[model samples]
Structure formats: C-alpha cells, structure tokens
Target: MKHNNKYERPKIVKQVDGLMNKVGRPALNKPFDKIDNVPVDELISNFGSPLFVFSERTIRNRLNDAKNTFTIRYPDTVFAWSYKTNYLDAILSIMHQEGSLAEVVSEMEYEKARRLGVPGNKIIYNGPCKTRASLERALKEGALIQMDHLDEIAEVEEIAKSMDVKPSVSLRINLDAGIYPQWNRFGFNLESGMAIHAVKRIVLGGILKLTGIHCHIGTFILDPLAYKRAVEKIIAFEKELESKFNLKLTVLNMGGGFASSNTLMNQYLPGDQAAPSFAQYADAITAPLLSVQNSYSRKLILETGRAIIDDAGYLIATVIGTKRLVSGYKSIVIDAGLNLLITALWYKLQILPAQTYKGVVEDTVVYGPLCMNIDCMRDAIPLPDLQKGDKVVIKPVGAYCVTQSWQFIKLRPAVVLIGADGSVDLIRRAETLDDIISAEILPERFKS
Candidate 1:
C-alpha cells in the first residue's frame, strides 16, 4: 500500500469566510431543531453556566453502530465498555443495558464495574499498575486481567499463588501497526521479542493462566488499513506463540482505537469524512484474524472506549459575549472551558448554535470560564450574529469529557442524561464550594 502524502496539508492558518456567507441561506437553513428546544441561556438559567449536557439519542445511535459492526461479522464477539472513557453511572448503565461488559484500569474503575453489576467474568482488568487488593478482588470475581509490564506480571503470579484459584491472564502486545510512531509504552514490545518472553513467563509461572493477547495501536485512528495491518501482525504473533508454547489462545483482545464522529480540526474534511464507521472498523480488525486458514478458534474481543461514548455527550453553553478579532475574525465566549471539556482543547471541535438563523451570519470563537491565559474553546468559528445570552451546542464529546474533567477554578458542570423518551435526569451535580470544602480537614489553629 502506497502512502498518500496529499492529505498532509499545512494547518489552515488563514481564515475562510463563513459557510453562510459563501453559500447563503441554504447553509444556515440546515435544520437546527436539535439545538432549538434546549437553549443554552435556558440551560444556564436553570442549571447555571458551563453546563455539560448529553443526548441519549446520540449514545444509543453510536452504541448500535459499534455493536452492529461486530454482530454482523463474527458469531462470538464481546465488547467490554472501556470505563476510562466516561465512567458516569448513567453512561455505564446505558452500555450495560446494551450488553457491554466493563473494561477497567484502576481499583476505582474495577469497583465501579462491580457496582454496575457487571459479572466478574465480563470485566477486563487492564493497566500497568494494580494494587494487590484490587488484583485479589478482580481475580476472586474471575475477571480477565491483562498484564502490562513484567513487574506487574510477577505481582499477578505472586497474588495467584496466594489465591485458592488461578487467575486467567492475557499479555498486552506492542506491534508495528504502521500508523503510530509511539506504540512502545502500553504493551509488551513485539519486535524486540519481549512479548514472547512475557508469554513464556505467564505459561511457565504455573499460577496465572494465559488466555488472550491484547494490543492498542493508537487513538482516533482515521485509517482502516492501519487496523488491518495490526490484525495481521497480531495473528502472525499469535501463531508464533501457539507453535512455540503449545498454548491454545482463547481470545484475541484488540484494544480500542476506533474514531468517533466528532471532527478533528486538523483533519482535511471533518472527522466524519476520515472517520471510519463502526462497521468499517469491525471489518478491518476482524478480517485479518478470521482470514487465517487453520488458526485456533478464538473469541474476538473489543475493548472500545471512545467509539462507544464520544458522540453521546454534548457540552451546552450560553454565549456570554461575542467579539470580533483584530484580524477580522469573530469569537464567541462561553461558560465552559478546557477544565470540563478537555477533548476540545486536544482535538479541533465542531461548534453549532442552538437555534436556527434568525440573525445575521458572522465568524465566531468560543471561550470557557477558566481564568488561565491558555483557556480557549474554538478560534475563528463561523456562526450567526448573537446577543449577550444565546444557546450554543458543541458535540461528539461523550468520551474522555467527564472522566478527565478537573475541579479547577469553577466547579465541574452538571451532567444531564436526556433519555430516549425526553425525560432528563442529572447523573452528576455541578460542584459546589461546600462540596469542595467537605474533603478538607481544617487545622485547629486555622479554624475561625
């Protein structure tokens, strides 16, 4: 396969005129009812500024998209919800209802999975560091524990020896997927024969049982071929292990890197253009493994984090003010900042107005409530003329939004789950000073 250097255009530094200005009313007339009923100002007045609003419709739609991809391909495929993506109980409940098992990294997340009622066998315990207690709990419950490093593998072996039962384990593999230049951190190095060494350690250790192999190349992967290449590499590696150790691999775990619908601004066309749909990803990852003529039959498992939840969330904010840049660009300042929705800062975000075009079209920028100098939302976005208070909707933020949010200057935003029947429930409340101070134990001398 030849690499196409054509897509590598330098970042679009210069601004283009508003789509409405270039294309006129038709562009503005694209239905805005999705944004109409839930006005940003109304939400701000009711729930306050910098509110995080999520759509149940988007969640179900994207979930179905991912599930359909695998269901259509293989008879036995399991999707473990990567809890690190967005662990909000409401969101996890949705995935649970959709038949997704939990994939957790930390003791907190493992406990969260148990609390969510995910069966012990359904959970995949992943991460480099694990406390002995967490390991004991997960192993006792019969979870699929994926080992990250050699030290962790040794710890698992020691813990397994202490247990009445042997824990089922899998070794994480790092392969040359051809897309990411940085795949060395998470899994065992495949090229360096470290993965083979780890496999031997697990097999000969006599306490931990090797059940699967796992790898995650990169995140928001736009190219389907990258996954195909990864699948082929993993299959070849799987064959090598089976031949050397005489172990029948029970499952092949491909850690998730599927891209969601949200547009990465660096992308030439929006993320939707380059973003492979769930079905495309399923085909890419499954084809290579299934293609092998006489390989051992193993259950294909997906530990998808972002693709399942990224589109389910919406960050609704009120436009506090609007400013025209000195370079003739437009900006819209909002209540939410990088603290609550950090993905916006990491990826180029798509901005949308709550209501249809009743006002004139203009360029705009969105700002959050943080006082830091680096705080920004979207720079040079094109939107309609606005007043002091107007509703704005920024989307495809379901994954990595709430999970990574920090309680900085302002309290974190309220997360509301809008149900399929239009019923809204507050899954998480906005942070308060009292809530902040609750964790503090003031010294006697400092007490007023």
Candidate 2:
C-alpha cells in the first residue's frame, strides 16, 4: 500500500460549541463491515462502487412490522407507499406486494401508479396543485382526491358538472399541532375555518362526495406526543365536520411523517435508540381513534415513507483518497456525495468500513469527488483508517435519496437490490453520457 504522508497536520488549540481541540486514535475498535451477510467486496465486484443497494427482505419486514403494529391496534389500518419517498418500480412492487396503496401528489405520479396497475380507488391523490385534466381522469377512474383548496373544489365541481358521476373528494387540513416550522402551505387551515368552509362547499355543491380527511403534520417527527396531539385535533375536526354538515368520513389519512433510524444532525442519540418504535406510534394514533366508531368508521390510512424504507437501503462507495486536514483531522474522499446522498445535509449518516482493521482509527470527515468544497457526506465521525479504493457503506438511505437525487459533477450510479433469497438484481443501470444526452437537440443555427 502506498502511504500518503506528505503534509504534517498543523497543531492548533481551540474550542467551540462544546468540542475540545484534541487529536488521538479513535476509541472504537470495531467497524460495521457487512450487509445481509454478503461481504462488501462481493457487492462492489458485481455492482461496482458508488452503488445504491436495497434489501428486499428488509422492505418486506419493515412494512409488515408497521402494518402489524397499527392493524393489531385498530384492525382497519392501510399503508400507502408515499411515492415521492422511493418510487423505484421494484421498491413499489415490494410495497404493493406488502399491500400498500399508492399515495401520490402530482399528475405524473398518479399516472405512474395507474400504469403500474394500481387501481384508481386505491390511489390517494393529495397535493396543492392538480391540473383539471388530472382531476377529471382521477374522477373518471374513481380515485380518492383530497381537496387542498377551494379552487380545486371549484375545478372538480366544474368537471363533475360535465360528467355523470360525482367526484370522490377529501379535504387536506392544516392545524396547529404544536410543532415548530409549521407546515401551513399545503392545506387549508383548520383554526381559520378555511378547511371547514372548503368541506362545506364540497358537501353543499352536490357535485362531489366528501369521503376522507387528511393532515400531514410535518416530516421527521421524533416525538410520538406530537402525533398524539395532531390526532386529537384531527379527531376534533372530524367531529365538527360531521356535526355541522352531517358528512361522514370514510377515510382518515394521517399523512406519514414517521422518522426512520437515520439520526438527524441535531440529534444527540442514535436514531435506533432515540426514535420511538412503531408500536409507540401505533398506540398514539389508534388509541384515540378506537374510542369513537360511527357508521362510516374511517379506514385509518398511513403514508409513511422513511420509517419503513430508510434502514433497508444502503449506499456503497469506494474511497478515492485520504488526507490530513489543516486541523490535524483525517479526511477521506468517497465516490458518492450530495448528488446521490442528499440526506447527508441533515442526517448524520452511518458510514462504516468494508473491511476490518483494529488500530490507529481516527476522527474522519467523508467527502465526495465533486470539486466544490460543499460536497461532503459527513462532517466529523470516528472511522477506521482507510486507503484508496477501500469501500465504505453509508446506510439508512432507503428513502428520499434516490427520489430527490440529481447528477452534477459525476454521473449517477446503478441501484442494486438484494432479494430475500440473497439474489442480487440490478434495478437501475448506471447513467452514461449517452443517457444524459439522449434528449439534447443542437440548434440548427448553431450546429457546425
């Protein structure tokens, strides 16, 4: 092995934000080195590094765990795979196999679900923006469309007037759930009576049937008490709707904002230890809901994206180089970055070496290959000493990363799925220049 011992780290003494200026060997001796008993070397040899690998067994098990937790408590729970979370066809297939309905926000996603053979009724269409054509198609296909604004109601009403069938509609409500940076932009506010008024217009219009209610409090909710409080407000709103309009809700979509085992940057404890279990969330949601049962006993709907999938996904990348930072800290560059692992911005992503070595571990900063200084995967974490071409796994990336990933300085890589039978499948092929340039059209005036 070639040693990079060129620059001696400058010695400095400083302290900030409770961190002491200290340089020493890493305290931990062990490194997490495998996935599903498959050695990291085998995965890299077959799929190549800088790859996204998912465990089919993990997905199935998580979905089953969430489903069982809720259904065992309330008995009428339905899990809708949040499309924007990780909508790869194989992932959705796994979700659907575990009996998840498609919960989509836009026309493209709605159409994608339709193409995937998800029945219209099984799809919950929710978002602030829905074109008239999507509303018409959703209506004709018998989808459950949740009204986010009164204008949407009017558009759907207009479409219903021309058609012979009434559109099945629900209302997305916003309320003060005692959470910071409240999400009030998407739905009508319950405190302001906007939500109630929207529902009233739909019920009075006679052109649409108000059949469901929805409220997505926010994302990465660590406290189950926040959900408990949100559920109370939703239940109260449901009663108010029923009492005033005589409209019964057939579906209550408690929009999924469940936290996964990926630790937030601000979090002090590991996610597996700090975040509440599915059982706790189940209890918080279903306990209050079970107390009341009307003729239209609502089908409890959950659209969790991260909790069921994050821990199941892992990104394996090859270390390009290691350097000693000016502060005498170690820095390791990996082949993956914010382009493929955007969650690194707010998540303290767990990264581990592919092979084990015990001594001389140190505090390491993981960086991406991008020329930009901001292309870092982790800030400061204790990692085993690594060399060029060594592999590391950044995990709990099963949700949001792929859906929100964009190519920048480097080409995107392939995504491989490890099946329950330990069979490896290349779900997404690595992007190439041809793939990126397929849509390019040189202007006739500029073409040489």
**In terms of lDDT, which candidate is strongest?**
2
Q: What tens-digit string does per-residue lDDT give for candidate 1 at 252-272?
A: 888898888777766656666
Off by over 4 Å in 1: 1-27, 30-45, 293-296, 325-328, 356-360
Clash totals, every prediction: 6, 0
Pairs of residues clashing in candidate 2: none
lDDT of 2 by residue, 1-448 (tens): 9999898656552222223344333334455566887777888888787889999989999999999998888888899999999989889888987899999999999988998899998998888889988988898888888888888888888988998777667788888888889999987998988887788788788898888888899998888888888888888888888799887778888899889988888987778888889999998888788777652267889999999999999999999899978777789998999999889999999888877764455568899989999998887886766899888888889999999888787888999898888888999998999988899998899977
Clashes of 1: 6
Off by over 4 Å in 2: 1-29
Worst 10 residues of 2 by lDDT: 13-22
TM-score of each: 0.90, 0.93
Candidate 1 Cα lDDT to native: 0.78
The per-model lDDT (C-alpha) reads 0.78, 0.85
